[model samples]
Target: MDNIRHRHITSFQSGYDPVLEPIVFDEKRKTKKPFRISSIKLKNTLAPALATIRNFYNKYYNIIHPLSFTFLSFLTRFYLISLSDVVMWDESHFGKFASHYLNRVFYFDVHPPLGKMMVALAGLLAGYDGSFNFESGTRYPEDLNYTFMRMFMASFGVLMVPLAYFTSIELGFSKHAVILVTLMVLFDTAYLCISRFILLDAMLLFFTFMTIFCMTKFHNQKCDPFSANWWRWLIMTGISIGCVSSVKWIGLFTTALVGLYTIEDLWNKLGDLSIPKIDYLKHWVARIICLIVLPILIYIGCFAIHFAILTHSGPGDSQMSSLFQAGLIGNDFAENPLELAYGSRITLKNTGFGGGLLHSHVEEYPGGSGQQQVTCYHHEDINNDWIVLKPREIEIYDNETDVDVEFVNNGDTIRLLHLGTERNLHSHEVPAPLTRAHWEVSCYGNDTNGDEKDYWVIEAVDDIYKKTNRIRSLSTSIRFRHKVLGCYLRAANIGLPDWGFRQVEVTCDKRNNPKDIFTHWNIERHWNSRLPPGGKANYKSKFLRDFWNLNVAMYNANNALVADPDGFDILTSKPRQWPILEVGLRMCNWASDLIKFYLLGNPAVWWSGTVSLIMFILTLFCYLVRRQRQYNDFSPVQWTYFLYVGRICLIGWLLHYLPFYIMGRVTYLHHYFPALYFSILMAGFLMDHFTASCSLKTKNIIFSIHYALIITIFWYFKDTAYGVYSPNIELRGKKWLNTWDIVD
Candidate 1:
């Protein structure tokens, strides 16, 4: 039978009909399994389910990952959002600004008004009455709905993750790269910590993200310029720029990024012969309208709303021009005398930006001749008032003097007698406490016993309207030149030591620069028995002027926030130390019992990002050198993608960060948060570049490993942002870097 079957198989192979041949089965064959799935059967079983899942994913995949990120972000940011019952670092200040808004009281800040307005709106929705002062370390009242306010702020932070994902998608990042971006942002401890509080950082960061997102979104529309989606994204980009800038001046860095992108885009367009002159001109017009005009309008509109809301006088009145203060509901500047005269009791406000009222106290200076301390005070005080007297006056004038009315003229010698101390304003050739080159200004001698050094020759400076020789209260800008030393009296916003009351130092600048606004002064409050009251006629202030003045003042004041050379600021971090995570900020008191939030980034995320930045620079250099050597490492499309994405990320990071190094003001770790975002995107780009050729399985494995590492590190440092409830030994062990002040 075996031989027959073999012959038949051979005959069949030779194309012979072999139906008559008999076949035989081997007796040693194993029995078939009772239950088993065949390959065909398995494929058939899963086909429909797999098809359904694929269809659903294809239909909603765009929303799925971003939504997942958003949910995770909400979990991280909103967890224990109200953990602390006391005020934190910036909340003490920003919360008070918000309260000023709720109370409709005018106030000043170094930053723009929109962020504080948002906090106020949040607090209002949370049923807060704006009664709490939000003093530093003050316990929040039980009735305060602080949680809702925090949640509102955290909402911006939560949206940041989705924004990162979307921005990554717009930048043409691969699916795996996008996932990495979202995960990195979601688990960032600094971003998480800053958002879960009543601060402007979260808002500033959100708008910054929006600006970059809108910019990339608009970039993708270059092929379909002037289309509906293009216009939408263009307008949105402008709005985002405006919103971000309205939050803080730092937002201008992102604005600069967008501006550079636009300039490059237009420059390329300019060289394109395919584009018509008319069409190119339209492009210019569109950018001007949306990017330039629109943002300016939005920024001005925010100030309009701010001014409209804060109609009552408050602590910020002194920061504005007297005319602006007179417009407030509860200010007495409108009732003051119009003309300055001898024997008038007045407060001389420094005309410099962020300047204060000319003030003196009975306390003597610990250094610098030990005379009565003359300083610039921000708030109203009896010590701020001075009695205007004749140069030869030997006696202090009474409150109601019978002296004849004599209007002050330019270059007239006069005496300023401190009403509270009865001492004449005197300056000698002694170094000021803070400014060594300037002479020490102090209140010396009784009002009846001042010498020639007490004489100040008041000279009229340029007024807002025009030149003026005769001094008018609240309208004239005047400078006092010391008769003996010839130094102009100045207040450069330099603060004195504790013994000098921490008020701004009033010095007589030795330099004879006539244009020094720091030496300028104006009478804010004028009282005389002879002169008539000044009405609201000349006291009217234009919004544009006030806006410009306030912004300049803010700029000056912000720059004045330099770290004291004699003192160490533990919370301050240098710009160079920020990217490397060399230091962390203590966001609150670090007592064992109080819940603490430390502003430190996740090590895996921050260090990885820093490495990626260096790698990107090195890789770009190598690529350029290789290309110059006739090596074609990338195709045209691939090269374009590489350079485009690389430039945006690299330049964005530099633009946001490099300025901090040049800035005179003190910086903190949080200042680096905006720039960290750009670095994170660059990291995602680098990840994409490395994994572009990897198989799906390999890519999945790499992504999974990264995800695990990020999550683990975030978990280890989670207590930093989520609030450390109590001191623990385990917490100290988590401090991988010695520079990190993670524990007491």
Candidate 2:
């Protein structure tokens, strides 16, 4: 009765007529008691509980979500890791490299040494003895402990999710967006399958993730520049950059992304008038020391360790400089004579980076001039040896050295007697097997008998030591010019037909380019019994020179991996085909009885990410057009955040991806994995941005649907990556796209 009277008095005071207010209040109180009491009780009961739950989610989602995803990633990544127990895809290549490391035998590969060293370390820790060759499709030996090696590698893949999660948080992603990013990486089928193998791609992907994470962390530290956390993250970013680049040259694309970010950062800082000039100078110095100097040291340090471990000479000895080879434990380069003379038996190595030794075998070319095949070989053999002698027309050849001991001089006409074939190195007007513009070089006539066509004038270009105009072992850069045809002997890295054993074609190039290193030759193995042996000092290799030479060789070798025109590679793919998930690589033998794995990305994740990227471009265009008309849709901070996420994800994807289309090297679907990561991040960004205006309930509903969709798609395709247990016939409808070869 008192409450009703108070409510009536308050209602009358709030501009209702006193009499009407009392009547209305009495009627409402009598008629609405059950409804009003229940409503009040329900509100009182639910509001506090909802607030508590929301507060807990907001406070702990970062911690709980990352931990949850990490646990889930471990399950996804480590499952069935040892299912096949057979060498698959690039495992055959990288595993052999790991063996080379454990055996301490020098081997040359196109990639940098750090990733292989880590693989070797894993093998060493696993008790592997470096005995198995890891041939493709070969079952692992019972004692090899390959499962342990793979588990070690898979650990890197497992951490990628948490790294991406933290990186998104540092980039200021909303809570829901963070979840999306983590899920996309955690459930990607290709990443899951590739990570479970003993391969370098996992390590490469790991360091790439680390670098981006460090970059974002470092970027956030800019507000308090030069703080301890700032310096720590800055140094970490540098270390990550060095490590990623050490895995593979493809890692350089990630480094380039960091570089672009830094450039933009410094440029923005330059425009700030409030920053003191000295402070700005310090900024420059800090970045230079951390980003440039530190990474180079790390890179050089990897090589230094690589050089220390691989002290024994192996098949890769011939790929290095003669001086570098001489330092190897089992190499005979230290025993060779120092000088070149008329009767010296020598191997002529092309001075071009990654070039091979001039060699001739008894086999003749099936087409072109029918003579003993002369080619360039990477390995050392007796067939690579040639005797330097006076031209046949100039003097009668003898089996023994002349008593006068004539030294080979520059511009002297000479005949190269192939020691293994007993034939003279000769070139004629006939076209080469592959390089038709140049004359074919072959071994013609017996050592005791040769014609004027065999005559080659030795042209001294420059010496490596800058000490001599005369020919010398491992130092002089000389060229051989066919005296009769005036063509320069060269190895342009062109391959010959099957009949010529597919060795590098040796041609007498009609075009004489003085700077062409292919035309330059050095005597790598000199053998003159009369001459004294060169001491170790003459064969000393400088680190800088060796480093430069090895990098150039790696570049040349990597560039040579283009698809052979006459061959077809079913496993190969195109850049355009990758983003759409148009194809996948068959990772192992597909026999019905064999447990095979197909490397394909989850279709939902890939297709959605690609669509998001396209939408981002259109959305940005619309926003800019609206802004131009002064229709301010976003606040200044919101606009900056939008551009920041766009630049990082969009620019990163372009950097890692567009280069593949421009690259001449043969590409596979796995090559797009790194770029796909950025696309996933971009998708998360767009999803969060577009839903920002929605009510909290609506947003949760959408996120739940998306999460369920990704999980369902991942489950459906899990067998493809996990391993095809049943026959291929059971997977008929699994192929969502016509281009997917999953069924077969």
Candidate 1 per-residue lDDT, tens place, 528-645, comes to: 8677888888677789978888998889889978998889999998999988899998988888877888898988788888899999999999999999999999999999999999
Native-structure RMSD, model 2: 9.4
Model 2: residue 60 alpha-carbon error in angstroms: 3.5
> Which runs of model 2 end up more than 4 angstroms from their true locations?
1-58, 362-373, 393-404, 428-437, 447-451, 462-466, 484-486, 510-513, 535-537
Error of 1 at 248 (Å): 1.9
TM-score of candidate 2 versus the correct structure, residues matched by position: 0.89
Q: Give the per-residue lDDT digits (tens) of candidate 2, residues 1-744.
A: 443432343444655344323222346545522123353487889899999999998899867888899999999998888888889888899899999999999999999999999999999999999999999989999999998999999999999999989988988888888998999999989889889998999999999999999999999999999999999999999999999999888888899998999999999999999999999999999989998899889998999999899989886777788878888888878777877788788999998888899999999988887888999999868999998888765674443744766788888889899998889999998998887888999999986677899989999998766567578778778899999999999997787767778789999998888899899998899887777888777777778878887888999888889997898888999999999999988888777778888999998899999999999999999999999999999999889888988999999999999999888889999889899999999999998998989999999999889889999989998988889987888877787788878676
Candidate with best lDDT: 1
**In model 1, which runs have C-alpha deviations exceeding 4 angstroms?**
1-43, 363-373, 393-404, 427-453, 464-469, 482-487, 497-499, 509-514, 564-568
TM-score top scorer: 2
